[model samples]
Structures are given as C-alpha cells and as structure tokens.
Target: MQIILGRLDTHLGRPRQAQQRLRAAYDGGQPPAEYWAAVGARLGIAVDDPLAERLTAADIAGWLHPDPAALDLLDELRSAPVQLALLSNAPAVFGRAAERQDWTRGFQHLLFSGDVQLIKPDPRIYRLLLDRIGARAAECLFFDDRPDNVRAAQECGMRAELWRGAPAARSGLRERGAITP
Candidate 1:
C-alpha cells in the first residue's frame, strides 16, 4: 500500500501534505475517482490524468491480495464454529474486492468503513458493527493491529485485544475458549 502511495506521491510532486490528505480521504470513504480528484486538487495535478486512474487501480489491486496463512486461520476458526465477522477501515473498492474472494464467505458479516462512511477509532463505527451483528458490545471479541483501534473497541465494551500475529491470536482465542486447543 505504501509503495503505491509512494508512487502517487512521486507522481504528484512528492508533497508531504499529500500523504495525510490521501490517507484521510481514502479512510473517510472517498471512491476512486473522487479520491483521486481530491488528491489532484490538493497536489495541483489534473484530475483527469490517466496516471491517477492507474494508481487507483493498482491500490485496489494491492488490497485484494490477502495472506494465504491468514485465510487458513480463518478457515480453522470457521470450522471451530466461531462466528466470524470482518470490520475493516478500508475503501469501497476493498469491500468490492473482498466480496469476490471465496474466503470471504466464511465471515457472517463484512463491514467496511468506506461502505458505511465510518472509520475505526470512531465509536459510532463500533456501534454500527454491534448493530449489524445483532450483538451487545460485551458479547464480541475484537482484534486490531492498531492500539488506538483496539482501545476504541474496549471503550465500546468489547473484549478487545491488540493483534500481534496469527500465532498469538490463535493462542489468545484458545485461552479465551473461543476455539478448542
């Protein structure tokens, strides 16, 4: 993701401000065209540039590929009868890409910040997730690599954990009786 973004930065004259603008707009639910338009406006590039389109496509493509081992772990949890859901701070393109993946079927619900226009660390997004899954906050176990996001989930009354890696996650789940050893 950074590679593509870095390319975009180079294409847009490497303005330091572009990084924050791109990240904010992308996480705030801007679609490809709109997102590129915003970046172009900020960086003084032509919004209709072909390079922007190419970069957007590349960024979405980057997001489409998931780690194979992570998918395997998801499968293991599914077989364990653990109800799984995905709550990610990603753009609408990511949500579209995830829908096309066979592994996504393992999730009972897939919520993207772009689809809902709500990003993580926002209490409202967590509430929306709880509403979508028909569960109380305390009933859910949330995991996120970002400390801030994990903290937000805890504030929402979830039993949240800072995700270290697959091994740690699996071990934690086993310890919590979410999956059998």
Candidate 2:
C-alpha cells in the first residue's frame, strides 16, 4: 500500500548550484550539461574546461547531505504505519549519492524526475508513482517542498502537504492522522 511520506530535499542537503542548475534546465526543457557549462563560464571557468565535462557526475557529497533533524524525524516516522518514499526532482547522480547514505534503504521507492523525465507539478509523474506502487490516488499522502507540487498531488486525489521543516512535517503528518498527534 502507498503510505504518506515527505520529500527528500526538504530533509536533506543538496549541492546548491547543481540542484538549481539541473532543475532549471529540466524545467526549461534544456539539458543539464549545458546549464552547468554556462554556470562554469559565469564563474570564470572555461566552457571547455575538464571540470565542465564532469560537473554533472560530481560526487553527491559535492552537492547534498542528509539533514540531521530531518533524519531524526524520518527515523521516528519509520515506525509509523506507513511506507516511505523519496520523491525528488534530481538527476541520477543524486540517486547514486542517496545509495551511500544510511537512509537509502529506508524508502520503499525512490522517484527521481530525471529517471522518468517528468518533474513534479506534472500529474503524469504522480500517476506513475501510484501505478508503480499499486496504490489508489486516495491511498497516498505526499509531501513536497514546493507548493505547486503539493497542489498537483492534491489534484491527483492524494492528500499532500508543503513540507516546511521538521516540526511542520510532523504536524502535517499528525493532521493527516498518519501519526499520532
């Protein structure tokens, strides 16, 4: 069964530049490599520098990390009567980084926008998660840091919350009755 869970980045650290550049590129329907190359240029790095060639493949540590408070909350939620999932708008590199973290196996599924080429606020991706998990729309509760993504999930018939922080996330889950108040 699909269980209610919050977003990954809201509780984790990420490479600011890479994350921003990637999301913007994907949203703009442009390739991430091109975005990074341009970003490098802005930083005085030549577009043809080898750094530009491997920018996207940089180690996850070079980009994001797990937030301690968020991880603590996640640990608490792990015992709740709900399955967990990581819904992130990141490239495949982020997924690889997650694999090295202690919380990697905590989630039942890891959904990345790059994997499916469909970002949040796009109903099709939400439907894809539901279909892959064999859960009905109403059976899932999703949390996202972005209001648009949360609203999209609501439109897809799932209860959703805009995850602000640990306390906020806890309160949201409690309100949904996913956890005790």
Candidate 3:
C-alpha cells in the first residue's frame, strides 16, 4: 500500500498530499474512478491515464484477504446464538470486493467506512452500526485491532474488546458466554 501511495505521490509530483487525498476520498465513500478523477483534477492530468488505472487496480488487489483462522472461527459462530456483523474501516472498493468472498457470507451485516463515510473512533459510526444491525449498543460485542476504535465502541456502550487474534477472540467469546466451551 505504501508503495502504491509512493508511486501515486511521484506521479502527482506531490510528496504526500496525493496519497492523503486518495485515502480521504476513498474513506469518504468515493468510488475508484471518482477517487482517481479527484486526484487527476488536482494534478491537472487526464483521469483516463493508464497509470491511474494501474494504481487503482493495484490498490484494490492489495486491499485485504480473509484470514483462514478467523474464517474457521466465524464458521463456529454461525450456529451460535448470536448475530454476526462486520464493521470495517476500508475503502468502498475493498468493501465491494469483500462482499464477493465466501467468508463474508457468514456476516449478517457488513459496514464499511467508505460505504458509509464514517471511519472508526467516531461515535457516530458505532451508532450507525447498532442501527443498521437493529441492536442496542449494549447488545453488541465489538472487536477491533485498534485501541482507539475499541475505546470508541466502549464509549458507545458496547462490550468492545481489542482483537489479539483468533485464539484470543475465541477465549474472549467463551469468557463472555457468547460461545460454548
């Protein structure tokens, strides 16, 4: 990702601003084309530049992948007496790609920051998640790898926990009586 950003920065003749704008544009719910177009407008380049297309393709391709262990855990939870949802601070391009993955099927709801223009650590995003899932904040168990995101969930009245990994998540779920022994 850094490499792609660096390349984009070089292409735009901006040290870091191009990358920042691209990220902000995506995080703000702009589509890939729109994102590139915005960057092109700033740099006075044609939006159809092959370089932008390549960069966009590379960015989407490198976005994310499903963790096998996490998928296994999700499989275990499928039959448990709990609802599953995914709240991710990712671009809309990645969100669209993720929806096509089999692993994402287990989730009842998938909320991406780019899709909603609401990133983590923002209390409104948590509220939006609760609303979308049709649950109160206290009824949800939120897990995030970032401390600030977890803290935000906690502030929103959710039982938020820092995600250590699949093993720790399983243990935490068991401890919370959210899963079987």
Best by TM-score: 1
Clashes of each: 0, 5, 0
Quantify how close model 3 is to the true structure by its C-alpha RMSD in Å: 4.0
Clashing pairs in 3: none
TM-score of each: 0.85, 0.74, 0.79
Evaluate all candidate structures by whole-model CA lDDT and list the values in order. 0.81, 0.69, 0.82
Worst 10 residues of 1 by lDDT: 1-10
Instruction: Report the lDDT tens digits of candidate 1 across residue range 65-128.
Output: 6677777778789988667889998888778888888988999999998888889999999999
Candidate 2: segments with Cα more than 4 A from true spot: 1-22, 26-32, 41-45, 57-59
Q: List residue ranges in candidate 1 displaced over 4 A.
A: 1-6, 9-18, 41-44
Task: Score candidate 1 by lDDT.
Answer: 0.81
lDDT of 2 by residue, 51-166 (tens): 44455555345556677788878887888888888877776656666767787677878887767877788899899899877789889888888899999999999988888888
Query: After superposition, which runs of candidate 3 have C-alpha atoms over 4 Å from their true positions?
Result: 1-22, 33-49
Residue pairs in collision within model 1: none
lDDT winner, 1 or 2:
1
For model 1, state the Cα shift of residue 78 in Å.
0.8
> How do the residues 97-150 of candidate 3 rate in per-residue lDDT, one tens digit apiece?
889888889899999999888888889988998999999998999999989889
Cα lDDT for residue 17, candidate 2: 66
Worst 10 residues of 2 by lDDT: 1-10
